[model samples]
Target chain A: MIELVYDVHHQVTFRWLIALYFYFTGMSAGSFVISTLAYGFGLEKFKPAGKVGVVMATLLLFIAPIMLLLQVGWPIRSVWNHFTYLNFSSPMTYGAFLLMMYPINCLIYGYFMFKGDMKRTKIFGMIGIPLAITVHGYTGFILAFGKARAFWNTALMPFLFLVSAIVSGLGMMIIILLIRDRFFTREKKINTELIYTLATMLGWMIVFDLALVFCDISVLSIAHAEAKEMTHLLLHGELSPLFLGIENLLGKVVPMVLVLTPKFRSITTITIASVLVVIGILFMRFVVVYGGQVLPIV
Target chain B: MAKTRYAFVIDLRRCIGCNSCSVACKSENSVHLGVWMSWVKVIQKGEFPNVSRSFLPLLCNNCEDPICVTVCPVNANRIEENGIISTDPHRCVACRYCMAACPYEVRYVHPIKKFVEKCNWCLHRVKVGLLPACVEACPAEARIFGDMNDPKSDVSKLLAKHPVQVIKPEIGTEPHVFYINLDNDAIEKKRKVDVL
Candidate 1:
């Protein structure tokens, strides 16, 4: 048996601030994609969400990087340095461009949509699809490039993050659509069919997310000595409560069951599932950023 | 001409776990109280009469293929001609990406300035023909610092003569820190090495 006598602990590099940053970026990317669906892909059904989606997308993107500045010591310098000198090898460099371009595209897209210029709105929306994907996808790439953290180093991290962003975006869209129809519009009525369709989409996305996470965990559980330890940490160790109980159980699984089940497809159940998904995605970011480095590598 | 490969060798057999190197590094670098650029790890193994303790001096590996340089968004971390990887305080955004990427966990955020800092093999001292504070203060002479390319240097001689090992070589960082008589127990212990 061996026991540690003395060792120094450093503060976790990416904490709640980074998690919030991830959460907001995911929210922003999700809504941007949703906004693009009606205009860019010409999905006529998603027309109603197109306007509000662009608004949420832009505002959330604005707030996301503010969390990043607070987390880093030098905020103004960071912004300056990102443009002046960039190491393209770094995944963060990719985000600097995406974060700038995506929001401007969002604003332009929203502008045209509001001005009733369908052609211009469609053009901007098409441009935003890749920007939205890259903005949030690069965050995953940042974590993946941190090769020391076993959980963050996976190749599928970008795809996992992208899919989850869409899931959370759909969750927010349902709630937003309801509030808009009931309170914001001239006719005070809830669009049950649109809400149901969005909820259905959210359910399938969560299933896809679960399958991806299962693939990641299953491989990591027996990958290597350290990988096994990390899997153990999430499965039944200190982070298990957050990872298993809140993130998987309360967040993804419950929401999936609620929305996917036909008997449970009432307004109340769908709303609760939507709320759970938003909360769950937030926790997923926490689990990902914090849990990745919770266990010491050296 | 080939670049000089700066390397460090820790003779663990001579390391009595005195922590003089740690103290010397702190006072020289003005490292804050809560963090350390260099420290010694102590581990105890076995039970009672069979018990044995080992000391591991922890510092930046200054890898030949330093991951920190590759990931710095602002290009703050630079690999000098002498092989010392240096971080520019003015340029660093305190992003902590390097700290997370480093396998040795050698990097730290300055408690006040917030920019990341780590052991740079005492480039300031080495450039002016002085030994690193840690090397000079080591009463046991366990810590040897020098250019690995120069056959006359202590680091090169010790590295050539001793059975040296580097931690986590599988990641292929090509770490420069070498250890003599490294105890597996010191590193292999399955516990959170860092205490919050």
Candidate 2:
């Protein structure tokens, strides 16, 4: 057996890694689901998020792998390892399985959406929506099952991921709609009513997520073991800036401010807010991946 | 069944922090830029007046329960009974799950090859009955490579004579590298051993 440490050492910051992966995957799945609200199920208002959802999904899908690649030291050998070593118990193995499944589903869904034939392909959308949720939810389950990190080892992670995905997906949709309204077409212009409806759901989820985060931190603080040390890293250590500044401020607070403010309801204001929220979500992922590893009980 | 188990033990007390082991592994492995097959960690611990540091040479621990092995979707990582964790470059898809799974952060991907690569414990040299390039090159004689199962091995003899500890025993990875006279405060604080 190789001698290993039971403490802090330099490892890639995983503080927000889990969050980031889930965010991207959530975005991909969430966008697909939101788009289906219009394209698949014939909900006209949901059409706003659908057009831009495909593009955002593609962007997020590509970026998610980059996060995985950077975490692993070798990007090339990682490809080979996936094919050669198939351990059913490993979350990564399962993640790979879902990763493969996701794109195919997207492709099928995309064909109908792009071909302007979603109305005829009711079965695909009906099948695709649940599949999207499954793919994204499973990502959360993979992390939740790992008892090593307290923050991730929760039954709520899948719900958290799913909620965050919806928020992000909707935020992206609104921004895309606004952009389309400005540049492309006003046919899908989302009225304040729909935007508020999406924002209200996002508000609840964000508050719930923060509550879980607070509870997780408190529990870790009380336990005061390796997990506690990691929690400390998240709360007050190198990661504090992200945990305190961006994730809370940009991701939650600013977006909330945008949605709630009477004066802040302008298109430009909301667009900027959406961009910040996206950035905040990315920061959350960084903290989660890097934070968990910071104080490992080696 | 044929077993290819590989293992390593580092004598922390004797480690001069010269980084000769890291240097040797680098040249031998021809590790690409911005990446390493083996590396060193310098940890410092304690208050200003009592602060002390130690140099830790790190490589693939070639663990019995290798985290990298389980996380790889492709079977890129394997252990020889001699105890070396070997990576098949051709098989690696660069997914990096192993990097996340590994607590050590020792494994690095070659920039050019994009294959998961780390210290192989100089398997090619060991095959010819030569010590690992790093072991042979250590100026302080801080490392020993041998079969722990064999009581006659030098590593086993050393373990019997001295008290030692691994870096992160809590993770239960069962690392092969052993540290002699490791700083208690450093271990408690879980800080890197390198002070400088």
Candidate 3:
């Protein structure tokens, strides 16, 4: 007998959803890391990226929901349900609370980053540092909390997400520097020393993220039939090419080789390496968001 | 304890996957054309001879410990005395933290209003002592509405007798929506898995 399935309606689009997911994930990562540098590591030298990071975080604060709207296909009415509380245990409920906290923390961080006054910056920094990490870490928890998707059901994901944000944020800052140095400040010499330092850090981060990817995949391979089904879909399913080519080769191996190698030791080489790493990380985010949905357990 | 507690119960067995509930929800709430206030997800599972499809109408589960409420810095979302979670458009700074925090991915920010919103369970209807539009419009008599606290209520009786399931039980949202005959793979079927 032919099995026929029915539904109320199909309101999702893979293409747009995937695109938006990558964009927001990148923004979240990029924004979080920049803020981290200002707060967590106490990199007082890189104050500019810190302030800019807060702005990026706020922009992403709004952009993420827009991405959700695209997923829901209804921007206006669907949003109201968030306010319509039936139960308190829901993650959506917590997410709403976190959403509110993130921007406030970011704005306060932004205030300190730009505020020339030392006392105010100190006070805001006191609050902004941990807030930045928690805010970014919460994004990872949101994904992991969904136990239905094995791809996201990992504790390491939050750290992975947190570091990936740092890698991208540094890359973005470097790209901005390259542009500014190349066109805006043609007289000033390129900061090769800093590039080498960040490039090395980025190289290591990419390695760590890839290593986690390996462990996650290997563990999932033997976990259960559901994970196996998901693995197969990711490897051979709709997102396979992206997972293999963009996320693996471009995002992982190629960039790692470029950064860690001896031949590409110059500042120009490091900049190019960072650029590739940024592209790779963006592709990885796409895979993470879209991959979680394509292989469905049932 | 407290007398004021509000919630919803969905009868999955009777739902026919018709968009009437969603449509009724949109019109009654004056939601925009492209934005949906409530949604119903249809998941098909199993293969060939063993294939069995299930219909799960998704809405805000409106959990007991709302992740969205606590994260809001502006206090846009508030749990009323009656158990309805709502956002004050005036207070909402249009931050979408609630959207990211939600495991169900139901919340979205309005394009024009620039505030977060989701299924309010028709607060307007609830205030008037009437059922939500979705409950009133169901052709299959699948949707039920009543107070969980009121022992004499039909919903209370149904919950007492039937073994019901909530979506993503492992997350511990303590959702109030009760599903009957919901297959184990219902939420799994809708989930998409990714690698690399």
Candidate 4:
């Protein structure tokens, strides 16, 4: 008979604040990437959201690094150490550089848009797409490279992060645009077709996100003992309510159904679905960051 | 001119689960409450009459290929010349990447210092030609410490005589700490409790 020992050396070092950092950074990257669809690629469907997306991405990018700064033991020293004592082997060092560069790129993009310089704005948007992807994708890489946590160790982490970022960004854009339409005076009628296009985009992103998560859970459940134990904790253990109910049912499924259904595709329903998607992605970040640390390594 | 590699050899047969070494390490390092640099993990195996309790004293493995050193974004954690992995409190941003990267999960952020800290094989004492506090305080002399490069060292002699096993050998960390006469059951048993 195999006996289980009760060793509790593992304590969660990263907390809700780190989850917030991941959320904001992903949102920033997603919003920027979505902006590229309109500004960089000249997609007429996303054209109306071009300036708003860049503005939202710039604001979110500004907030993301502060969230990280708040969690460090010596917040003041981080600036010096990040530059002077950089370790190229660590993904976090690369992330720091990416975070620094991404916001500046977004700011420059926003400035060109503000000046009505479409040519320069498009050029910057083209450059911003890869920067935005790397900024948030590197966050996933940070956890994925740990190799110590079986749940975090996966080749799919960067892809999952990038997809989720786009989903959350689309969700935020929908809500913000809806609010802007309702409260702020517009030179043109709020484009109903554009809203529908974004809802469809969100629906597909949610589908892709769900598929990625399913792949992750299915693979982990079949092999890898430590990962199986973690999947058990996520699926059937104490975290089941958050993972199954909040993230899957309310976050992904409901939002997908609300956006995709013909009868439920009204403005109010789409707004509600978008809000749920945002909340769900936040919970996903929480689960990914905290759930991975629940199992004791020793 | 071989590089000095310090290591630990613990004879599980001699360990009585007394936890004297834990106390010695705490007092020697002045480690705060609710955290430890070294501690004895007691596991009860089997059922009723067949059951036997075993103690595994857990500490930093001081791995030759220390993941903690590689994962630190600010290069706060470093492997010393003698292969002892140490953390610089001033330099550490305390991002806890080292704590997460460590497969052994031995590193902890000191609540008071707010810096990532772990056992450095009692380098302060070792520099003065003294044994680590845990090794000195072991009443059963269960803990052995020495330079693995020195053929005449007590640890080298004991390793030569006995079949020894390192914890989580598949991790490929090349841990310096080896266990003598340890049951596979005792080493491989999964912890049943939620860590967080």
Top-DockQ candidate index: 1
The lDDT values for all models are 0.89, 0.68, 0.65, 0.86
Least well predicted 10-residue stretch by lDDT in candidate 2 chain A: A1-10
Itemize residue pairs with steric clashes in candidate 1: none
When 1 and 2 are scored with DockQ, the better candidate is 1
lDDT of 3 by residue, B28-103 (tens): 8877656677766666656667766667777777778776775554566787767778777766655455654565
The best candidate by TM-score is 1
Native contacts retained per candidate? 0.69, 0.27, 0.16, 0.52
Candidate that beats the other on TM-score, 2 or 3, i.e. the better one: 2
Ranking by lDDT: 1, 4, 2, 3
Error of 4 at A96 (Å): 1.3
Please tell me how candidate 1 rates in CAPRI terms: medium
For residues A1-298, write the lDDT of model 3, one tens digit per residue: 2222432222222344544554564555565565566555677655545555667666776677566566543345445655554335444455555566766766766666566555665566566556556655666765665454567767877776776766666666677656655677658666566556667777787787778778777787787566676677667766678887777777677767878887866676777777877787777776776566554332
Local accuracy of candidate 2 as per-residue lDDT tens digits, A1-298: 1233222234342434455666788778777777777777888866656656766676677788776666554556565556566777667677776677667666676677778885544666777787778777777766564444555656776776676677677667666666676567646554666666566555565676677667666776777366666666667776788888888777878887786577767656677777776777667655655555554423
Lowest summed-lDDT stretch of 10 residues in model 3 chain B?
Answer: B187-196
Candidate 2: misplaced stretches above 4 Å?
A: A1-24, A38-97, A113-120, A134-160, A181-190, A220-226, A257-276, A289-298, B1-6, B32-36, B39-53, B138-142, B186-196
| Worst 10 contiguous positions by lDDT, candidate 3 chain A | A4-13
Q: What digit string (tens of lDDT, one per residue) describes model 1 on residues A164-237?
A: 99999999988898888988899888877778888888999999999999999999998877788889989988
lDDT, candidate 4, B1-196, per-residue tens: 5778899999999999888988998999888778888887767777778888777888899998877777789999888888888789889988888887788878777887788888889999988899999999999999999998889999999999999999888777889999997766666424544534
Query: For this target, which candidate reaches the highest lDDT against the unseen true structure?
Result: 1
Each candidate's number of clashing pairs is 0, 80, 58, 0
